[model samples]
Target chain A: MIIAFTSKGTDWDSKMDPRFGRTDYILFYNEDTQELSHLDNREVADQAHGVGPKTAQKLFERGAQVLITGNGPGGNAAEALKQMELKIFVGAGEMTVREAYEAYQRGQLAQGA
Target chain B: MKLAIASGKGGTGKTTLAVNLALYAAATRRVALLDLDVEEPNSGIFLKGKLKREKQLFRAVPEWKKEACILCGKCSELCRFNAVLKLGKHILVMPELCHSCYACSELCPENALPMTQKSLGFLRHYEQDGLDFVESKMEIGVEMATPLIEQTLAYAEAEIAGADLQIRDCPPGTSCSVINATRDADFALLVTEPTPFGLHDLSLAVETMRHLDKPIAVAVNRVGIGNDDVFRYCEAEGIPVWASFPHDRRVAELYSRGETLYDKVDSIRTGMDAIHTQISSLGGGK
Candidate 1:
């Protein structure tokens, strides 16, 4: 399973970005392969409208099974992510990607409402 | 001729000038006053007491048909607004983000997505003192304004055919909504105040009108309250300053009470007459 974290940087130590639709980078961790990757979303952040829904499309196409972030997707985006059956975890906005991932592992982060 | 009343800054009295000019012109000519600020169309508040006609407005968007599923994902790819999406076997459609362009529905390979009408807003018309008042209000949650403005313009075109003048009151700022309101106009009257902030925003509104290639003029409202910066800016750009409505307590009281200042105030009557004369000349030009 692939886990995605909306982050400010490409690495795990980088701070987690709370905004799902306008995050700078979506850092990913592959469970089976143990590989790390990222998708840049800075351009999507500057879109005039529907940025949330567009960001949701990016997460869905990347085969993300889990989403870890500060605040989860907004209404339009939440609808798309819900349809994709992706698990979303919240309460990691001020933390680093590594810390958020650790919290997810320890079952500390709550599921997004 | 389509004459547009627009302004860059809010509360600069675009509605004031629009209603007053349409009223002055309607005395001797066939006139239709269209309030194109659909987001908050308070211009209708001053109209005479009657709702002659009302119509619900809707825009077309794509609807996904699960039974006709090809799972091609073409609709999602074609949508620029991201209103359509394909998640696994199911396709999701959000109508609020759709612009009603019909691109996704027409280009679908398997004909799975069909165009469906979604409620956007409402339009109303009233016959006020020989002037036809047309106004529209967008739905509360609707994000886009251009689609509804387009629909209202079409309705106004039908209602104002053979009319002597079609005066449109544009939305504030030089955004897409304002463009949709004033793009069809032959002459545009931009309303502004005398402050520096008004001058700054007035320049932006002028740039937008320049891009639209419309002949433009300016009206200074509440002349005594602020400085002469707006007048200087208009003179520097060679844009005519058509009317200057003074800063008067009576005007404020009348406006707050849903009354027009044309018949009661001498200065306002003269200002509206000047605007009416200029717009009338444009009708003869074409």
Candidate 2:
């Protein structure tokens, strides 16, 4: 599965434009499946700076089985990911994208669980 | 009349000007103050008002039906925000990532997309010293302050539409939230200190206000601290300098203690009075 990491809250990718201090979109692609998804740090809630709801959608599209970040799955973002059946792991701090993917590969993460 | 006090950079006395203006306006007219600085709203700290009402703000996100799903990936492809994802038999929606533009649901031929509301922040109203105050605080971990700022402004509009005047304490930077705050104002008070950062951001703020076609005036706080770059810009642009406050240690100390400038400096009281008069004349109000 292909997964992407976006700096936006939880919106679709087509809705965002590239602007200064608002361009936090990261995508992780699963080459085998050609799927893509994304993630955004909870810090985005402070101002909606570059974070939107599309980050979650891109992550799911890229086949992100698990999401690890500073925010839990109880807010608006969690509900969106819940609909996608993606696991949410909150308080995942300072870990690189590779570290997060490895944790997901080990089946060690779930939605706020 | 509604006046928005805005600055492009933070810590440039936007709150200071807003609070003093609100306090000064309230002395003669029924005034309302709306703080659109959701990130770090300092107007409340200065005003020291008692909370009277509070409400949560929310945004909607689409939900997908997994039971009758064909996993055709049509919804994902049609979504501009990339908020929809299809993997194997699973379809996912990320609410925080959703802008609620409804593109996914509208384009979905399968009719699998449904929308649900998610809380984004809190809108609080308070009253102190005959001034009504409205403030918004975005919930931690939820992005997208535009919706909350929009909702908060709507609430303020409903409550203060008939008032004689309203003061909006706008957020820093020329972002969407700041646009939302100042879009409907009769005039904007662009507050800035006389520093390099102040001048650079002031130019950006002026550009934004001009783009929105809003009439603007400049208020130079900490006037004697820095050079005359702001003055030169205003002179060249022909933007009126509404007022100026010298860099007084007592005024700064009062501000540090959460007091309005008018409360500390008696001369500012006269300055604010003149500003209100000038605004009234411009707005055709007595």
Best by TM-score: 1
lDDT of 2 by residue, B1-286 (tens): 8889998878888887788888877877788899899877778888778889989888888888877566788877666554666644777665656689888877777777877788888899998877999999988887778888888889987876756778899999998889988999999999899999999999999999999999999988888888999999999999999888788889878877887777558767766876787788886352
**After superposition, candidate 1 runs with Cα above 4 Å error:** A42-47, A70-72, A87-95, A103-113, B283-286
lDDT of 1 by residue, B1-286 (tens): 8888999999999998888777878888888888889999987888773788999998888888889878988888878788887776778898888888888888887788889888888999888767888899999988889988998999987876867688898999999999999998888899999998899999999999999998999999999977998888888999999989899999999999989889889999999888877776666433
How many residue pairs clash in each candidate at the backbone level? Answer: 0, 59
TM-score of each prediction: 0.91, 0.73
Model 2 reaches what TM-score against the true structure? 0.73
Candidate models: Cα lDDT each: 0.87, 0.72
- Point out where model 2 deviates above 4 Å: A1-113, B106-111, B284-286
**CAPRI band for model 2:** incorrect
Per-prediction DockQ scores? 0.65, 0.18
Instruction: Show the colliding residue pairs in model 1.
Output: none
